[model samples]
Target: MDLLGNGPHVRQARRDAYREEDSLRTRRDRFKGFTNITTGSKGEGLTCCFKSDSDVMRVIDNVMCVEDGVNCNNISREITFMILNFRYYYHGHCKLRLGRRDQFIHPFVRRALWNDEYLSKE
Candidate 1:
């Protein structure tokens, strides 16, 4: 749909694969120019601590800047945007889709992406 004009460069996923750029805060999976999620309920936040590019860095910053007034913990919030994770080296993409009424992921899925039994079972 070309919703986003261009794909953002994800850092967290990149850092996991390769450690080339140490200057950027690789731990922050923030992309820049996320001006839309603020008005919506289905917002996104980055838990990973790796950053690869400027756009990502900015996005992460935007999420962190959310005020305490926003009650995001409420599951009623419908998260439409996908907070993606990417690294610079491997060019692999990992997207964490979040939705309201969804429970926390299983421990296995949270751990090794492959050892995650949920994926194998599927």
Candidate 2:
């Protein structure tokens, strides 16, 4: 069954509707200082039903992540930096190491630190 109707026009209309909804969500998140990056079927405007779930990744601009050997001269001092350690590999994710101990780290991230070095994937 064609949930978005049979014609090309109908499919385009459905996609436009989804895009509008996603745009509104992005604007709302931006007001709270977070950038919402949508992923999955809903993000791609392939959602044919309201029951479909939207995968969203929220990024805070105040936090930055960079790999080792990357230049940090252009980064703002006010932002928190977390080093991405590709050396310590997990199943599908790279390890995140605390860049500087002197800077302020969020309580949640602080609690997740392993051995006062890398952040736990848990």
Candidate 3:
């Protein structure tokens, strides 16, 4: 079958021709897929990454910290993001609760971050 002879052949050829061009699109899709995970984003596609559950808890623990203490770039990344797992802090923050065996739901994990019950001592 010639590359562009029949209708089906033409369609297949077009798909194949664009596959290379769609590499960037494919990467974007895979990147977007990461948000589907519990350790991933629970809200919309747009998000700002935090450091750790404990860190988030620390901020939420203090209503004042949540406001007067800006958690923006001004704050030290090491202090704001110092989590139980150094590896996770080094890599990327996930939804794993410290000293627990289960993975909490994405939203709940985010919520637990505000709760002192889930906060790690360290």
**Candidate that scores best on TM-score:** 2
Residue-by-residue lDDT tens digits, candidate 3, 39-99: 2221221222242231111111111122222343443322223223334344564333333
lDDT measured at residue 37 in model 3 versus the true structure, 0 to 100: 19
Off by over 4 Å in 1: 1-76, 99-122
Q: Answer with 1 or 3, whichever has the higher TM-score.
A: 3
Q: List model 2 lDDT by residue over 1-122, tens digit each.
A: 26545456655676677667657877877756666666676555555646577676777657888988888767666667888877757666787766665566655556656455244432
Candidate 1, residues 50-116, lDDT tens digits: the string is 3222332223221221222344564333232223434343556454432222544433333534554
lDDT for residue 103 in candidate 2, whole number 0-100: 61
Listed in order, each prediction's TM-score against the native is: 0.17, 0.63, 0.20
Which model is ahead, 1 or 3, in terms of lDDT? 3
- In model 3, residue pairs whose N, Cα or C atoms come closer than 3 Å (at least 3 residues apart or on different chains), thus clashing, are none
RMSD (Cα, Å) of model 3: 16.5
Q: lDDT of candidate 3?
A: 0.34
* Candidate 3 displacement at residue 118 in angstroms: 23
Error of 1 at 79 (Å): 3.5
| Decreasing lDDT order of the candidates | 2, 3, 1
Ranking by TM-score: 2, 3, 1
Give candidate 1's whole-model lDDT.
0.32
Residue 80 C-alpha lDDT in model 1 = 29
Give the whole-model CA lDDT for all candidates, comma-separated: 0.32, 0.66, 0.34
